[model samples]
Target: MASILITGGAGFIGTNFVRHWRRAHPNDEILVLDALTYAGNAANLDGLDQVRLVVGDIGDTELVRQILRNHDISTVVHFAAESHVDRSISGPAAFIETNVVGTHSLLMAAKAEWLDRGSGRPHRFHHVSTDEVYGSLGPDDPAFSETTTYSPNSPYSASKAGSDHLVRAYHHTYGLDTTISNCSNNYGPYQYPEKLIPLFLLNCLRGIALPIYGDGMNVRDWLHVDDHCQGIEKVIANGRSGEVYNIGGGQELTNIAVIDAICTALDRAFVDTPSLAQRFPAAPAANGQPSASLKSYVTDRQGHDRRYAINASKISNELGYAPRRDFAAGFAETLAWYLENGDWWSALLDKAQR
Candidate 1:
């Protein structure tokens, strides 16, 4: 049984990963370190009993070092990142502070803790990153392979790129058994409402306009949260040190397509249900309008990438990682989760808006 330390274990993807790992490895002792920032909700871990949650920042070097030493953590899963691109646009400083500096501090703390524990005990530091570090992909360009050069276009991605570099440096310089996995867009239950899927879902439910940036053709590879968690577990268990893996479900879909799919799902879900039908009526006809009626075009975001796709062949071939949930099934489950668990996201939205 391994003793693991996970940073940002209260955030969206991080929380999901912690829950997944606890269930998968029942004997493992899991310690979650979170800053309890605006985005990090302790409520995400309300019913989870196996995880030992500590409210702290990854940037807190002394705190992190203490946690590492006290927990006897053999693995460090770094998932604490300021990841929202729009938020990064509005405020880039937080991104740099939390993503770059915070990661560096955590790595140093973990390195010191590892040394104190004696080099004989096996230790691994796994960094979870996003595919946006590769920049935009053209229509015909190949998917982002593990070898793709880092061309971060947004502040968020740039900060993450910096963190990724730090992780690599630690592995090469200190031989701190480490691995990095870059993943595509993830959508599933417990996701904060700031992202596309939950944002659109909540907007649709609230009778608010669904904002589509530009022509709404920006493409993204959607991976289920469970699949991403599985990929991380695979890397932690079997990944090579100083290596990078790309994890993706390969569910390539355009932005407009995603909005349409969600609406269609809601429409179907509403049908044959009086309460839901009362909540959301059928959309009006086009009325000779050239643009789609369901989505309203909004100002394009700063430094928005037109496309992001990952070549997940490396992980699939090397670690036998395969995404079990297709978009349809996965999306259905995600939508149902939001519909069923309104209180969780409602409280999150309230806090974010505040």
Candidate 2:
């Protein structure tokens, strides 16, 4: 019967975690704080039990303090951030504001309420972060371990690095109970259409050109959202305070290979489910052509990391963490979700256009 606070609960990963937490701990009371930004959709958390959504910013320290004190929140899962790399490149200021300053503010509220104000109550603050903070990995380089040095390459990663540092400082400086997880790329349902998997899936449906940056050979470790959520759950439940964990799916695939996989999946779907061909008539599969025909090469991004992989041995050995969803089945389920829930994403896209 713990009271928990989840920031950015309306966003992709946060939403999944909130639902996951509810199912695992049905008696816990949950409060969600979100800014209702373009990346966040309140409707995502609609109809969930024992959950309250409060539209607000994490940067509002006093507001956060009140939420903490009034609700008697014993745990906070911080997931609010401006996380898109391309968006960060074009506008670094927002990244710094939300990721760095906003995180600092949230920590201040927690310290004031849980530490300074003293209530003998147990508390935890878990920070969710990315593996990009370790910079790029060469072809033969070892996967990023928890001991990897900080070498953030992009504005988004740099900002996350800053937040991670602040969380560490709070733990050491004020003895605030805290833990952090640096995870690899996540893809699943309810993800905004800006990321690679969802964006390409939507484009394939509309017959739009699939843009491939550089030669498309850059590699990434793909972690299913469900697996990532489970890892976070393990950390929150059994993690040692002031420690860091790396969560990964152990599935590595090149960008071009992922695109080809998506194309192949769509081709099979169109053939077996004839109605898909009627729904997306423009898709090359509808007319007996390969979806790969729509590939469009483009300029590479600035400071793009060559590769990113995570070493999850620490979490596995310490917390018994292991990814459950294989890429093949996970990807097929993700694609099926997008196809079946057209109304959900369509409304978001329509709003964005307007």
Candidate 3:
């Protein structure tokens, strides 16, 4: 049985991945290492069995080495990073420290334990990354393919780009088995409120003004977190080492369009509950006008990319990977989850205030 170490396993994507992996590989051992940052919630993994959580920093070389040796970890899925673009804009130091330095330290530890020890078995190191590393796209530009040159526009993507290069360097220089998958924007359950989807959902539920960055025309390829997790698993199982793949949901929409969809979903969800009108009187009416009216265009984010699209044909052709979730259906399900799981997210917000 293979033992896997998943870094940042308590964060949004990491949490979903851990849960998915556990369900797929019940007999395999799974260990999670997370720092429990603002975005990392242990509750995401609550009630999960046969999965151990090790709260620590990924940059700690000795700690990582110890975990690898003690757990006999045969696969390392690296997802630990500072991912928010706004946060990275305000403070780039943390981004560099965590995304670049932390990734380097983790790579070093893996090299020492896996390569130096000469483990005869086929070991894998899968690095989860973002498509923002390719910078913005024109109105008619083709989706970003694997061969797209790095043109990171924000501090967050720049740090991730640096880490991606490090992973590639280690593979070519030391023959370390590594694969990287750059994915589009992910939205699903357990996502922090700072992101666009959850934030808009929460704001709309509370009858607060929904803020849209820029002219609300920024385009993003939205990927369901579950589909993204499935793609990662496929890569781990069939991807070639020293290669990069793109994972996308193929659901391209503008910021305003996504917000409108959320509002419409909320309207449908509350149709049966008359008491919800009293709760959020400002919610959109049946005509879908007021909810769209609640939209308040705000100042654009600094260095915000105009568009982001991913060409996932490589993974689809090579590993038979195709996104199965329809955007409308997946998005409606995600909205239902947030509406029903208020207590979970409320607890997180309460902690953040403290």
Candidate 4:
């Protein structure tokens, strides 16, 4: 059986990707290595017997080497990283350690494993990345393409950019078959509450102030987690080695607009909640007023990128990788998932501080 080693499989995108992968490739063996960090939850992978979950850091070179040998892992899909920009600003050292050094360790281990095999048998390494590596874009600069120059602004993005370069170098210098995909902002179930959409959703639910950074006009192309996983599958299955594909939602919205949309969804969903009554407790009110009133602007993050969009033409045209989820439907489904699964993340958020 073809074996794949996936890092960060307990986190948001990682968990969703694992689920997606299992369904698409039922016969493949999946070995998930995750540190179970604050954001990574064992509960996320609770029912998947097909996956072997191991709690460990990707930085543990020897451990990774052992896992590769024991499992006979031939493919790797790396998703491990310090992902939150706010946290990265407060503690950049962790970001560097995990995103850069950890990737290096994993790559070295994989290289050693490949060398030990010493054959032309096909193997692939898939690197999952973000569009933040392209930094901010003006309204008219067009979306970031696969060929866009790297201009990472935040420490998190910079670290990920470093990892991306390392993956490319491994492909060129070490003859490792690797594919990279840089995706736009992802919003869906299992995402940490610290991100924009979930944070606002929770804040609105609890009657807390919804914090918007700066004027909240920064624009981002939002991709659903499922769409991103689909893109990764396409890249892994059909993409040219050492090539980067940009995966975009094809729907762009300002930060303020996104918050407004969530608030609208919440208000419509919770017409009888106490928070809604406190904000707009009137029978004659125009349906959705209170959710919009929860907005509370905060100081913007340092080095916050203004706008990010992706030119996904290459993935679509070349690999026939059309996104199945559009922004409106995907956002609606995401909001529904959060509402239906409050216990999952509420417990996670409570434990994250401890």
Among all candidates shown, the one with the greatest lDDT? 2
What's every prediction's RMSD, in angstroms?
Answer: 2.8, 0.8, 1.7, 2.9
Number of colliding residue pairs in model 2: 0
Better of 1 and 2 by TM-score: 2
Query: Taking the tens digit of each residue's C-alpha lDDT, what string does model 4 give over 91-203?
Result: 99999999999999999998888765685668888999999999999989989998889999999999999999999999999898899999999999899898999888877
Return the clash pairs for model 4, or none: none
Error of 4 at 251 (Å): 1.1
Tell me the TM-score of each prediction against the true structure: 0.95, 0.99, 0.96, 0.94
Give the Å shift of residue 231 in candidate 1.
0.6
**Local distance difference test scores for all models:** 0.87, 0.95, 0.92, 0.88
Candidate 3: tens digits of C-alpha lDDT, residues 1-354: 789999999999999999999999999899999999999988899999889999999999999999999989989999999999999999999999999999999999999999888776678999999999999999899999999999999999999999999999999999999999999999999999999899888777766788888899999999999999999999999999999999999999999999989877777777766666765565665334456567898899999999999999999999999998979989988987887797998898788889
Clashes of each: 0, 0, 0, 0
lDDT score for residue 42 of model 2: 93
> Superposing every Cα of model 4 onto the true structure, what RMSD results?
2.9
lDDT-based ranking: 2, 3, 4, 1
Weakest lDDT window of 10 consecutive positions for candidate 4: 279-288
Per-residue lDDT for 1-354 in model 2, tens only?
889999999999999999999999999999999999999999999879999999999999999999999999999999999999999999999999999999999999999999998786899999999999999999999999999999999999999999999999999999999999999999998999999998888888888999999999999999999999999999999999999999999999999989999999988989889999888888888889888888999999999999999999999999999999878988998999999999999999999999
In terms of lDDT, which candidate is stronger, 2 or 4? 2
Instruction: Tell me the spans in candidate 2 whose CA falls farther than 4 Å from its real position.
Output: none
lDDT per residue for candidate 1 within 1-354, as digits (tens), equals 778899999998999998998899988888999998887888888777668989887889999998878777889999999989998998999999999999999999988888645656788999999999999999999999999999999999999999999999998998888999999999998888889999887777666678999999999999999999999999999998889999999999999999999877766665544465444443321122211345788899877899999999999999999999999999999988987887787787777677
In model 4, which runs have C-alpha deviations exceeding 4 angstroms?
Answer: 272-289
